[model samples]
Target: MNWSWLGPPMDVRPLFPVERGAFLDLLNTLTAEDWERATVCPGWAVRDIAGHVLHDQVRRLSADRDGHPGPAFEPGEALPGYLARTNEDFVRTARQLSPRLLVGLLDRLGQELDAMWAGRDLHAPAGLDVSWADPGAPAPTWLDVAREYTEYWVHQQQIRDAVGRPGADGPRLLRPVIDAFLRALPHTLRDAAAAPGTAVTVTVPGPAGGRWTAVRGAERWGLAPAVPDGGRAAAEVELAADTLWRLASRGIEPAVARTRARLRGDEALTGAVLDIVSIIR
Candidate 1:
């Protein structure tokens, strides 16, 4: 995933209005029982997931206020335990709010995020470590935020799915977010020891003709223009965009790559590709 190609580093402001609108629109249509349904995220119900999203937004503001990059849970911290605790806090805080109040909270959070990034220069430092839900890995701050958007967008889909609703507006709105996820690949590859110079191609089936080729070099990884060679890739692996997104987001077994991806070329290279793609998000 060559996320750097998503273009200039700007605040996530542009996504806010659209995201908020979608969130509100979705909320207005939900039944009370819809909030109790379980989400794909293990052990979290729909309301819990909603609370966590809102909680993360509040925490972002607090982190900004405290003059820290973000929370850094210590090594050996129990990932699920921490998530449960934080989620509990969020649900408690939001418990008093009606569905309309929850919508208002999300709207305000969106506005603040928009204002925070509006007309501001926010550059992610190289190799910044950020705590994530995964215990085995910590992500870069930029990737951390990118994952947040992915979560918001994907879970928005999950909410829709639970209610038998149609998909979000279209792929165009998600291109930038997808690009951000792709851009994090170098870090993901390096962390997984796949690095650059290992020849591999990742094909994401499209709405934007999604596909990418990442070649590992001596010093760094380079992303080439993605051109599918008519199913004749040197080392080809194909997956649906949603499956790739879920794999990247750590929602399922990384080994699912073997079953889901269509692979060809050296078996070792296939392993490398799996390793590289598995650790992202």
Candidate 2:
């Protein structure tokens, strides 16, 4: 019921331990065979993804320190090709060392990140323009670095799933990251219209309830509270937040959402609501 703005800038110090702890816990549990299993990320086995994550941490830290804009991904390279190349490089490097050695590398990298963040002013201007492969993508800076924590957690889950291990960390660790992704959704979805003159509510069902309202207008869009008159019934559609997040991130199917979602005013509005969330990922 609380409509507070989610995913604002956070102090990195408090967040680092949680992120590092989760990473360490995950790596500690992996057997050699577990690392060889295929991950959900295409072209990446579990070990390959783990290696890439480690590589990213090192690269991002170097970029942050040297004031280099993060890696320049070539626009000509397809997403799969770029990721495959990066993953292969990481896996090859990791393969040269023992798993213990790889874990040590991650620890050293984490310590470097901790030290850099401890002394550095995150808001300070880094004198470079970093771009992602996506057109109109935001620069890869401290903000992106913070968001990477979320990616780390999610991808860690992929590793867990591949190995048949349970993800014991609760929503608390994921909340900030999820909030960050949700906070950016409106701007990303503005250009995609699911319907005109329709106000929709998206409810994420959990122990703690969270809701997002998207109203379509003639020339613009507005986001507000999905309360009072805008409960689940007043809105055109409603869904579990986890379901929406997974679908938005392309971790799940829109068709699955269509079947599972509760519809109210119009079915078209459900499609529109999905359209709004879809662009963010």
Candidate 3:
């Protein structure tokens, strides 16, 4: 399950065009009924998901490409709540747009997004932090872009699941998504009280999966591709790549993930691994 071929600091900028092309192709093949089908995103249908994707592109283009700032948080609002409210608000209003219009916008804006990403310096500080990965700290441009790829890929999978028209699940597409999501493992176990040198290894056993170990350091847990030399993992968790993606993205509940996952070693560490979520919610 270890991805020795693809090393750390995943550069997902190369993936944007391919994933976006696949997204548009998938949208064009949907039937009228398919647009109305329910997706794993609670209460959001296929069209809603499409509209959500459109909204994401528009917001990114405006903010990143055009340097336009987005709306500020309301009084007393939290990050997760603000994001949830704004996303739901957009999807609700977007329900009025025809499917054709949604796809058309995605086509145009997707190109802009791809271009924007192409011009970014991967080593520079990102516009915003990937909160789940390194909360309150500036993320590198590469990690930010990788997070964007995972978002688009996960939402596309949601649509495919609803309509039973799967595509873009190959190792090329999914491996980066899994790797990007695994960046959040350190933050996920941030509060866990573990002695230095303790390590937890998570393995997704499939073509698209790989191994990641989060080792406890003097002050924090750090995620890496391999465990340190002579260090044995204090806990290990194993699951399919499909389950890992869904679990990381909140497509499935942790209770459900626990049933599907195999656990060994410390219960608290394994439980923290199961609770790892890549999204704001």
Question: lDDT winner among the candidates?
Answer: 3
Query: By the lDDT metric, which is better: model 1 or model 3?
Result: 3
Model 3's TM-score against the true structure? 0.94
- Candidates 2 and 3 compared by lDDT, better number: 3
lDDT of the candidates, in the order given: 0.60, 0.60, 0.86
For model 3, residues 225-278, the per-residue Cα lDDT tens digits are: 577786678999998889999999988889999999999999999999999999
In model 1, which runs have C-alpha deviations exceeding 4 angstroms?
Answer: 1-12, 65-84, 124-145, 191-196, 220-234, 275-281
Best candidate according to TM-score: 3
lDDT (10s digit) by residue, model 1, range 96-169: 67777788788888678666545343454423343322223433345555555666776777677666776663
Summarize candidate 2's per-residue lDDT along 1-281 as a digit string, tens digits: 12122223445356766777777788888887887899787777787767777887777787767666644567797655775666567678776666787778888887787777777555543333222111344433454555566566666777877888866346666555455445444454465555544566666667423665655556544465543353342355566656665665567777887777777765555565665442222
Q: What TM-score goes with each of the models? A: 0.76, 0.75, 0.94
- Candidate 1: minimum summed lDDT over ten consecutive residues — where? 126-135
Candidate 3: stretches off by over 4 Å: 1-7
Q: Between which residue pairs do clashes occur in model 1?
A: 1-182, 3-182, 3-183, 196-216, 196-217, 197-216, 197-217
Task: State the displacement of the C-alpha of residue 153, model 2, in Å, after optimal TM-score superposition.
Answer: 0.8
Which portions of model 2 show Cα errors greater than 4 Å?
1-13, 68-75, 78-84, 118-146, 194-198, 216-237, 275-281
